[model samples]
Target: MRNPSRTMLYSAAGIATAFILVVAVNIIAGALYVRGDLTADRVFTLSDSTKKIISEINAPVHIRFYYSKNNPQTPGNIKSFASRVEDLLEEYRMASHGVLKIEKLDPAPYSDAEDSATMEGIESQLLSSGERIYCGMSISCLDKSQNLPFLSPQKENLLEYEITRAIWDVTHDVRKTVGVISALPVLGMNKVQPTAESIASGKFAPPGPWIPFKELEDTYEIRKIPLDAESIGSDINLLLLVQPVGMSAKCMLAVDQYLLRGGRLIVMLDPVSLYSIVKSATDPSYRETVSCNLPAFLNAWGIKFNNNIVVADMTFATRIDMPQTKITYPSILDITSKGINRSNTVTALLEKIGLVFAGFFEFTEGATLKKEVLIHSTADSMPVSSFLANRPEMLVRNFSPSGKVFDMAVILRGDFKTAFPDAGKNLLRKSISSNSAVVLVADTDFLFNDVCVQFSKDQFGRKFYVRKNDNVSFLHNLVGYLSGDNTMINIRGRQTITRPFLRIGALKSKSEQEYKNKILDLEKDLIQTQEKINNLQKENSGRYSKYVFSPEQQTELRKFQEKSVAARKELKNLRKGLYGSIDRIENTLKWLNISLVPAIVIIVGLSWAAAVRRRSSSK
Candidate 1:
């Protein structure tokens, strides 16, 4: 009923006022708040170790972000992936209750604080426009005594572990040390195999990269020795036993004492030595060999190694070229990338890798067991005889794969009393209150040189190929997990190292085979159609001149040409789909985001609105 012009002006004024109020409130809240994003599924996040370390943060964690809001040289480096680094750090603050503090600093071109960030190791690559920008973050606990330089979150799918690990290392008191023992050099593995003469001549040749033990120096302390049972102690946190040959009775007893005292160990024992072709290739009538047995100690702890049976799986079989033009792929004990435990911390961030000549273990009756199958072969796997005298042929068939796979590698956990109850009495050590801890891997070939490597020496006298430890991400995870605190074990989230297939499932083997055959048949048809189109013109070669003159011939040629064009278009679409799944996956991720981010936002808003209404009523 009032003046129209006055009403319009009032409406406009109200909108403007609300905008100002929102901006002012946001600014005030931001001063004391840090922000992070969980929108990315493949974001660089913190590792479980790092997460635990952050959770234990008693003092506030201060973060000063130095970024160029407007980068001149790179034009839009401010929009680069580095911004995600800020988002991740904010996540840490959100998880940290007021203990984590965050601050943002926009350094001017000629500012002293910018120089300080640079001096503190926050590096920035200069761009062409002569504009220098701040591109990283610095975290400090207490003084700069514990400073973390985080430049950018990683751009990989599984980068959270590395980011978190760096944070943990910087935030924690000291890095945990893992103890390693093997016949091979721990790190600095040679690309080329040292001649047998090298080991015999004492030249000290390191093992290859694929030899699972490569790169031990970066993450652990390698205690290279011939371990007898008596040497396990509190000084050693994790013991890695790789193909221990002739471990003296004294050494075995020492190991028993160590486990009895509640120590952890990773044992790799092979059923037979496929380690050296130089060692056994010439024995045409080779028998199976059993390499490692805990004898009595393993049994006492409810862990038993049946060193006699060789595991053969159908799904993950390896193709070995045998002597009789035998290029048949035996369900030859392969524990490739597909075989690793996907949900476990040790095997999560891994791809395809393989193992060979593996053994299996059983828990003795009445043995307390917390068992996890760390590695297994395909469904078409079974046991072959495991003796040096038995020919490898028992497992070697004409690629007749059946889906009979079994566990070649396992992780056994529980309180283990020493095989010799009196063994630890010498040192006067009591069993752990909850009983001591230990780890056992039945197959030594899992870490050997040949099984983990592929080699080709070049004319330039260099040898190189895929490294066995290329698959060692899981191994490193295992090392980090066992030696580390449990809180750190699942800092981010706990995923399995291996996933169990639905053995009793709705999908049968025949259905799987038919599905495969259908795809193959479609591919064949596509190929045949293309070939027919190419030959159509050739089929008319005899009457080339006549056909060129004939109306009927010309009409038929036009039909063929049109049909061929349509077929080509269809083929192109199919090819593009192979590379287009990622886009579809991303779209699906976006659609599913409603299940995560949007829901959180709505809940928070509703709760805030409810609180505001309640306060107004009270007033």
Candidate 2:
């Protein structure tokens, strides 16, 4: 009751002190990084293999970020973006359990460290003349002898992955064994394949996920074999088989036994080939084409290969020429994004990927199957004869009139028991029984080099894009998914669409030279006709030169005019006969580009992204 003013003063001072403490904590929190993963589907989330590498780090890791905070490239406007990048790295550091450290360095006063960033492959563009800007990073593992991939600290979205992968690689030694055997060469030098040299030379080409596995000579031992080779090694963790043509029954059985031993298997078969150089327009090489139908293990797993055909619809087709809307026949088979499953890891985060020249498979209901169509034909698709695989001539409107849809591609799987009655036994050793699951695909042409090369240009006067099919991606995911182990050790990659120019066709020898000679003959005929018309006009130059007239000169002009007109008409007809619509091919491609590719991308991109995200989240 005494001294009320003094009591009030004391309460006010206490309130002020609490407020100051709160403000101080907020500032420190802003400086420090915490995790805020709002993404419903963690596509940007660390892959299982990647996560394993990071969790296994036994020593402390340090990452130094070298970015000029005041540089033109690091404008105040984009500083928020930079801060986000900084925060992401901090999250990795936090995830590392005090084993990760990050140091921010503002390159000061023409430092030599700035030069090192460029040499380490951190790309920077010039914001102004003579003013170059770079954002660089160096990752150090506690171990001195381990190898790590270089990373750009500046990029957004991928910053977390970049930093974490680099840290894991440098900190821990990756030592997992993978085995490969395929019709398409990847584990070997691949010189026997078409783009082998280009792929080998690292010509800025798209990388197949299998390349890293092939390059693991220093860490893990790699074993290779032909499709016909029998008996896979027992110690192999993953086995790959691609486009096995005329493999002996024993070889196929060997693969089956390997899987029976709980070994991972990836089989890439095809219903029909889109790009086959089978000696002619009518080559009978369906040996692999028809034979690749997965006979035993597929049905055992409750999956079905219809051995049918697929055709595209107007809704899903990509146009090669818009004015003419010349679309590529069979070249563009539209798959509904619904074909992708949100529950599967392989395609959960996939987007509108162009599997240029692919086939689909279907599943039966008899077995305990969890069937997911990774890619499917649109409702507008219909079945065509497999006989038409190489018929480029069928790429016209007449071939695909309207209204036809069918299912083409599928990914079928489940806790498959076995195709063989006694499948529990191992491939090389009878003591071990197989518990490994099976994953199979019905397309093989997409894996070949020529099918994947950018063979033509686009309508924008740009080279057409050719992203090598996820042939290798499909294989790597198959093994990783089936194994239930994240240490597969070789699946970090990016692929972009490719564009190629038409200026580099091969020179023809005699037989093909004869075709060009025929074209030359047609050209000569056209020239002669043009010359004759010119000469005829010269004689009557005064009257018919401009050719504006009344009736007065009718008789005199008749004979000359009739001959000139007839010659012109004949030459036009002859040109049409020789070239047919071949000349229109270029124009058609232009039209297709304008009308088809963009529309296809938009429709597919939106639909596909939604489904892809769904799948990614479940994984």
Candidate 3:
């Protein structure tokens, strides 16, 4: 037999040993800066771009993080986000090899810390209870400083990118210049002539620059290039061409020469530009053009863009709810991860992009340039007439899957040959090297402010724009990559924190498709029935009055009514089945979550007890 005192002593010693081991491991981990990130995307792990930026820092950078930790009125979510910010900053500090210093400050009301935070331009969040909280950071490198007024939780995916950009900004001295050439007023209206009636009514106001243009201005110097300019300035770092319509031959040659001389270019073409239509509605002088393209340049480069045709994808159709009915507008695409090329750094982190009446590109035979598609439509896509883009209902009714994938965006890299080979000897005939690149996007309306963002006001009545999707980020990434700021491109728009149930999503999509097909069949039958009724009435025109229906007409009408009722019943059943299936799956998941761990624990406990009993009997 065993002594009870000895058994108690052994148990106590084992517990003590486990506690000591946990403490020692934690201490060693802290000292050695060791961590494990088991997430699939490694969200907690620092990106290679971030590591590279941190490693190159020779000057000491000081980061001051201010949070109202002592304020009881501070929100719980803000506190949690602040903790995450601290952890991320700690990681940065560790990676910087002592060059990055972080100081955490909790500013109380009317304290010196608060005053310091205010001086650094940190924005304070005012609560409903008349209290203020601070959750911002200020980074300084020698004399240069950058302030992030507030760290918004909604922009969590961009947290690392923002921090790295702040560090880079303070260290860098020069800002690159971007040249903008757009048929639309992207840089705001140049001159607004006040009409006599508007002057009397005091209601005339010229539109401002696009939101994306303003965002670009914050990071780079934006130069407006005229459409009729003879040459593109050499000082322009990157050329942004949006809706290149009404450009003279000389201007086209200038753009071609710019590309041939190793200049980076991003062109945005559209089969149907809704923005132009809207502008025409407001400004009578604005000429409305449904399509725009750089035909001369694209044809020479062995890329074909049909300005009269718009891409329609059933798989990526965006559903729009109208006042009368709901429609899945095939012309308006919502490209998801499957369509975005994940291997490309410029588009890897972007989740979704919205495009209106977008076009597609095709590579001609014997194309010499190396081409990579950044975004494409699904196989269930086809080209439709641009004229039908304004009529969503008709477009949906006539849309058919072509079973061919179309390229929406592409990156071409090579030594581009001049489109104007017969031009004067002063211009470049070919690129100096094979490193030049040009990015082409099929749609330009996605960058419009109304399509990509929504207006919102804060508690202090300050206006801000909230992103509707990743369209703005996609543009930023393109600009960053082309301008050789690859570090920021890598870290921007990282993996989303929400892990969706893809299986459930697939099931839902399948069910919705089935229901839609049924509805289409019903509509077709209704149309046929109406046609038959009309034919019968024509045949019996002399035999029956207008109000009184003949036997054959009455029979057809009754049959149509019965079919409509049956369709309604079938639709109801389909909706019920869809919800029922989802509910069943959710319940099963809930049960597993509640019982699985406890069940495993009980089984292990019983197994260990039985083993101990057997060992005791053997002894």
Candidate 4:
């Protein structure tokens, strides 16, 4: 007995209210910068450094992201990556607080956007359907523009860093100048006297400016400072001393004063640099023993340095070719994350760092400077004297592992006192005003090209470099941090996408070790049996007669062969069992991940429904 018109009007009013509320909610969401990141690593979240960089921008910066989205020719992966890029760009816009403006363009063929993209030198890839797809971004500030050309999906880990760095570079107009002070050929010492054979062969160039120097040149201006040079150039933003040897008092004073005056310093001292061996091997006049020391300067900075000792780590030794065969040299340490200082910005994101014939350091008594160790040797590390360290053969013969940790690198930051307090005009400051920092690395060979890069030549005779480690990134991050570009400071080397199960990994390693031991034992037995057979044949051999084996030798051979077959079968079984165990674990994890949550939800829902029915029945 209700009025139909009145009921219909009330229903219409309710529908209208619901629609209005939905529209209002959508508008509010669109206006706000709100996103819930459910990713485990929070990969979509902007880092604090990125947020700071965006917030510090005083001028407007335009970021044009050109992507071919929903195109029939574009790959699905590229489209997905473009969506991620868009999300990141949106995050940046939100963080910038209206300073950053982003524009997304589809740049259709023959369109004005396409023409603009071409003019900006953005690289385009031709799809399988003959349609060219663009997936690059360009950032501009005032008159300065930086183009990424092509944003490679393979380099997604470094995408955020690259974008931030480009924006920083465009906004900041000056490139830092670095001064190099080293006796170990960083500036590529030209031959004072050239040989006639070298001239004829067209290989008569300098020994090297070294590979690390060449890499640094792409970022900073490297000016060579001689040991005899009395003063460091005022224009030098950072001072790098590599394998510094035979430095005079004046040179030491200049360095001390430079650091006191707010100049950044990177000191690399080697107990025995391997590069020096190669350099001196060719020239008799070149010093066979290369060591550097600034005792007074170091003592003043509250650091105790020993140029006569080398750190040898058994747990982290790198295998290298020595004379006739490859052997693991304890003096050549490969420092992993266990040795790296994660709290410091310089070594935080670095994965592996290689050092050759490195030295170790310790803090002196009553030290004033604040010390932070950036690299550490394992508990299985010990120090070897410089004399034994210089000879590679001695390292193989005499080196013994000592279960003790050693400091490989350290950063000291504090107001430092003058090394020569009484010397007038020679001392710059008795006490430095602002807190200055200097990083001390225990090895010089970490910068060597052979250790850090793999040089290759293509079919067309073009040479290119493939980086072997994150050394270059580490160096850049350190230099950038020292130069006050905090945007690049927190950037890690690269993100690793895949994470393994530790329990499974441990099981696999243990099984593999056991299998290896069994194989080695079987191989030893086989070798002994072969030797016995050979001896029997040699003892019975005659010039025109047949080579015969004794019954004992034959019996031993049969036994060894049987043992070998048994070992092979055992190895095969071990491998199969190892894989089976791994597969079972993986399958169990997969099943749990796929069903546990849904099963819990169903159980909870059923329990609630049963409780509600029981309550109704009780009522």
Candidate 5:
């Protein structure tokens, strides 16, 4: 009834047509369409800020991407990451619309590409097989150039920001100026000759510039403003005031005038500066108890910061483990995501920030400025005397939750009126034709190296710092926002791309909490049992011999020992149960992942064959 030859020819034609259609569609997409990023955080998607920066490019910029594609010794992860980097560069080139050119080079062993990479300052990694792999980039525009010597996977979160910043830097010839005013030696103290006693004590080395200050120096022209300065230069883009102590009225007036003239200011006030106390041990001229505030300016600005009060948050306390005891220092806080404002671009991507002896801020009555809290403590936080900050045990013993949140960092934007309005000649009484912004951080010691980073030395004896938290990133974000580099601010410190197993994490946490409670209860029971045994022994010692225990005492001691063993067994069982449950879940997930797709495909295939057979029989 059917012509098999004609049917076969039609089927072949349809298949060929479909294949050609697919090929044409792919070719058109490759030419006209940018690939979509479906990740939850849009990890591969170029952000709007990045697109904006790319659209503003007027001149031709070239990016030389050096990658070791042919090297067998290169790790699989590095190769995958390089592929992603190449895709990202392609996105940039597409977005630039011919303004940005990307040149991908495989610097094989002893090749000319390798020499070019070396000359461009791209760093190479040595493999176990003694082969070097290059994976970095150099950006150039006209006469300007910048090199990222090494592309580290650990810093992938900041990859986009770094690349965008390099592009901006090469295009922009002039660096912005930042003025620093501080009582503390943030710009590094000059080296002093070590005395015989100092050398013997091994505590006389002069410290270099603070890490935050040095980081700023790499990007901006840092000018150290004296504490006694009568005026600030107009050329300064931003003024950074850190731990301002004993400022003269004239200097305060100068700061006031600068703010009133629409200058951006970041003031780091500390209620109790631990860094200052440490420095005082080495330098007698430094204050033993350092507290800084701008009372005059704060009053005029309708903000309140009590220099004598330090904030203590039970929820965000940092734990210190000692040989004798483990104490939670409430004044030293490890601010988590709950404490940061996720809606603000400056702090959105920050994971954790460490602060020592931080204070809190409050708005005064009828405040005119628009206030936003960038970072704050929880409802279980309270203000305590600054002097009690160092006494961790005492603070923990006496801490009372205030049932109210406290602002640790705040931003105020408005037409700010000057605190020195009565001053004569050439001084602004209010912000000139525009609103000004001021960022107030409650602590300065967080920016200090002791709290922010861990110092280390490599095998080559090169000194480096490993950041312990997001303190430096936080500072950089604020500075970038304040200095009108909003593109970098938006791109810096992206959220981590890894998606964790939240359900498993929750289960583990619940198990841990349960175990902790059980341990506490067992310890309490053991303490009571021991006390009873001791009392019985003391009472029976007069009637019986010292070495010989009474029946009641022996029974009590036996019960206590049995209880201790039982507690141990219970804890062991609890741990075993937790692991067993996790393993079971993991195995189920593995099987599901391995078999689900194939099972569905098989079922669909059987269904289609059955339907086809039924139709043929009916025919």
Candidate 6:
């Protein structure tokens, strides 16, 4: 006989004690800082570059997050992302150890907080009910300020990168100056064909800069240099030389001197440039072959590239629309993750890059400088002559795989000897005493407008250019690497938590290879059968129109028709088998993922129950 009131009192006391313990634990956690990032990719952990930048903060930089909480106008997904953004900011705050202060605000509609947010440049979205929802960030240090107008969920993957870049920009006052000396129309200066009306009006405006060039202008000061400039200005931080054909000896000497003085360089040299063809079709003066090289300068830098050869890879071929036909052009490479340098910070995170008429490079044997290949072709790649690359039809006819990998891009670092050491060049250092850096890309048309950008009209009929690939990102990252800004370069292509299944991928690849062989055999049979039918029909048509076909011709036609049908059936069956194998494997994986944990739990439960029964019997 137990007292129900006493038992109820004990239960109540236990619940109160548990609540107090939880509250105390939470309070202690808030006072102390601890972060455990258990994700495989360390998605929550701040990158080393970000931490380094934060650690060097001398002045106090404050970030204000203006979020609309519990507003019916705000979408649920955005609210979740807002919480993630706050957590990320907390990581930054902890990493900064007090140099970075964060202020989170919930701006109610028409409230003073909302007014403050609007003044700080945070944008607000209006709902159907006339309510405003704010989701953005504003960072300020003393007088200088930087604002992210809106934080869209579409760009959530770039949240950390955007915030870190904003902080770095607000703190840094100087922008790097990049000097360009391009033979092609990189500045897009009056290159379009003259129209009759425009000619009559005498109104010809210079063409706007290409999309990539426009993007660069947003972050860097672009200074275009003349082709025959005698000297490179000392104020330039990085020098970009594209298609440097027919350059004067003095200009080459000037470039040599610039590099010897520790200047960063990005050189785009191509053996065959399709973009040049388009530009030269209208203007003969700009019509130049893709043979441009400063041999004296390149040899001294421990780089050797044949300006007469172009690399063509079947594994990475990009399709081109030609006259009356579409074909995959091996010279225009569509480089994917497999071809990029995953270990190098400059190219590690890039997905796909498009390059036209690319060439390959190799270092001279016994070279003094250290070289690292940044982009490479597949094993089924070979170097083709520029003659084949110029003619689209001939390129396909003469294509063959060399079964070797070629280097499409590389970084050369260390001391470089001047090629004209004894040529009485004034003030020439003859060699770089300390290590210097230069990036050599074997393609020139990668940044061209026709290849890198696509134009589209919005619903309002306004036109805009969109990047077709990561060429713009690659160029920006290269310049950032040259300017010694590691924060933007390191976080541009990072994938925090997307892990792929390598084993399943390998199986799929194996199946594809088998299927490819089967398809090839079927195509051969179909081609042969069609040829026989064509000959029979040609002989019959060439004779009198009223003449009937011979018995042998009739038999041959029927046989060929039956052969075509059988080939089609076999091809269909091959595809079915290939898909079936892949589907079965996928289903097995799904079942394992759904049941493995529960199966283990049941096994453990049964073992415990049996042990308890045995112990009772023994007692």
Candidates' lDDT values, in order?
Answer: 0.55, 0.52, 0.83, 0.76, 0.82, 0.79
- Look at candidate 2 and tell me the lDDT of residue 493: 27
lDDT by residue for model 3 (1-619), tens: 7899999999999999999999999898877855689998888878888899888887999999999988898988888989889889989988898999999998898899999999999999889898889999999999999999988776676689779888988887889999988888888986888889999998988878898788777678899999898999988899999997888788888888888777899999988888887877876545545578777778777899999899987777877657833467778888888799999989988888999999999999998888999999998778988888767656666667788999999999876888776777756665446578999999999999988888887554456667777888899899989988777776766645566565665565455555666555655665676676577667666744653676776887788767767766775665577557777887988899999999999999999999999998898
Model 2 CA lDDT for position 287: 38
TM-score of 3: 0.83
Using TM-score as the measure, what is the rank order of every candidate, best first? 3, 6, 5, 4, 2, 1
Residue lDDT tens for model 4, 265-298: 8888887777777768886554633677778878
Clashes of each: 54, 33, 0, 3, 0, 0
Q: Which stretches of candidate 5 lie above 4 Å from their native place? A: 1-34, 184-213, 246-249, 274-290, 314-338, 342-345, 348-354, 386-400, 420-434, 449-470, 493-495, 499-619
Which is superior by lDDT, 4 or 6? 6
Candidate 2 lDDT over residue span 1-619, tens digit each: 4588997899899999999999998998877754555554444445565556667877777777766677754555346665666766765665667766777766644777666555455545345445655456777765442222222222243445445446655765654566767544345443333377786777734434334343334344467776677687877877766656566667777876677667777666665554333422564453344435656766767665644443433333443444711224444532224444445666554433344444555556766756555555554445555555444235332344345334344444445455556544433433233355445665655444544334444221223333334443444455556555435323332222233223211111111223433444444555665665565556556854564444645544565456656656665565455345445655777898798988998999999999999998897
lDDT of 6 by residue, 463-541 (tens): 5555566787788899888877766776655533455554654565455445655665676688898888787777777
TM-score of 1: 0.54
After superposing all C-alphas onto the true structure, candidate 3 shows an RMSD in angstroms of 5.3
TM-score of each: 0.54, 0.56, 0.83, 0.70, 0.75, 0.75
List residue ranges in candidate 3 displaced over 4 A: 1-34, 189-211, 284-289, 320-326, 390-393, 421-433, 453-468, 493-495, 504-513, 521-565, 575-619
lDDT of 5 by residue, 410-434 (tens): 9998768887667777565654447
**Which of 3 and 5 is ahead in TM-score?**
3
Residue pairs with clashing backbones, model 6: none
State which candidate, 1 or 4, has the greater TM-score: 4
Candidates 3 and 4 compared by TM-score, better number: 3
